[model samples]
Target: MTMSKTRSEGSLPVVSLPLPVDVTAPAVARQAVRATLGGLGLDGPEVDDVLLATSELVTNAFEHGEKPDRLEVEYSDGRLTLRVFDSGTSRPKLKEPSPMAARSRGLQLVHALSDDWGHELCSGGKYVWAVFSLARADASA
Candidate 1:
């Protein structure tokens, strides 16, 4: 796997990687996000939330979406954005799984953890993105 970083004057750094479309995708994504967030000097519950959400996104792509392409993690202005790209036509939905259900709560967890989340259709497929506020004060309130 190859990782790239981009930064400009007054712009925050972005770390992106092309993910493998298999069981290892989630683990790979979590590792990348953990290192990236740590390097940015961020920790605490907010960072944990980001890591969990990144895993869910990557897992969804590997299971439901087609040709999971890339994962991007970006931190800017006290906010963190995680996006997963896939060459799939169907979009992710937030569903309320039954309490006894064995699965299908990934998006639900994402919605609860993230300040805002959505998906957008791109040229070949779509990308689902989740945004989190890294400010501890905001999270408490």
Candidate 2:
């Protein structure tokens, strides 16, 4: 994955990540998120939550969708939004895993960890997003 930034002369700060659809994408994304959040002075459990949520989303993209074009991490209005854009039409949904199952828990983890999560179908593909507030208390502990 490659990290890129775009900001107007006086506009919102946006950080965009373009990652290949591969197994290593999740690790790369985590590192990028850590650095970004650290630069923004967000650390401890909150950072951990964001990392976990991002991993789950990225993993899902690779597992269920076509090669994703990018993963976006945006910080605006005191909220952080993580998005995975893939060339897939199906929207993600939470499912109940069987007691003995080892897979299919990514969405559940995301749902429980993120303050708000959803998806939208775009012209070329679908994008799944999870939003978290910087000032919210850590509820995962």
Candidate 3:
């Protein structure tokens, strides 16, 4: 896996990690997100929420999408955003899982944890994203 950090036009930090299209992707994503966000001086329950949301997006990409590509994290204007790209045309939906179900709650958890979340179709495939408001997150801490 390859990871790099860059700056957007707004001079905010953006980190991207190419993820392996396997079971290990979620763990790898969590580790990278923790280190990257921590290095940016972000911590506490909000950061943990971001981590959980990131894991859900990556997990969804690996399970439902095709050829998961990379995970990107960006911080800008008091908000942090994460995007998971995969070569799949299908879009994810927010569904309420059954009480007895063993899975399918990833998106629900993401919706609860993130300030906003959605997916978009790109030229190659699609990317699912979640955004967190740092100001609100800090207030909750």
Task: Tell me the TM-score of model 1.
Answer: 0.90
Better of 2 and 3 by lDDT: 3
lDDT of every predicted structure (CA atoms) = 0.87, 0.82, 0.89
Tens digit of per-residue lDDT, candidate 1, span 1-141: 677985532465788899987899999999999888877777887888899999999999988998899998887778888999999989788888999999899999899999999999999899999999886344345
Ranked candidates, highest lDDT first: 3, 1, 2
Candidate 2 local distance difference test against the native? 0.82
Go through the candidates in order and give the C-alpha RMSD of each one to the true structure: 3.3, 4.2, 2.8
lDDT of 3 at 93: 89
Q: Alpha carbon lDDT of residue 131, candidate 2?
A: 91
The parts of candidate 1 lying over 4 Å away from their true place are 7-9, 136-141
Listed in order, each prediction's TM-score against the native is 0.90, 0.88, 0.91
Where does model 3 exceed 4 Å of error? Answer: 135-141
- Best-fitting candidate, scored by TM-score: 3
lDDT agreement of model 1 with the native: 0.87
For candidate 3, give the lDDT of residue 57.
96
Task: Give candidate 3's TM-score.
Answer: 0.91
lDDT of 3 by residue, 1-141 (tens): 567876673765689999997999999999999987877667778888998998999999999998889999998777899999999999898998999999999999999999999999998899999999775345446
Q: Total clashes, candidate 1?
A: 0
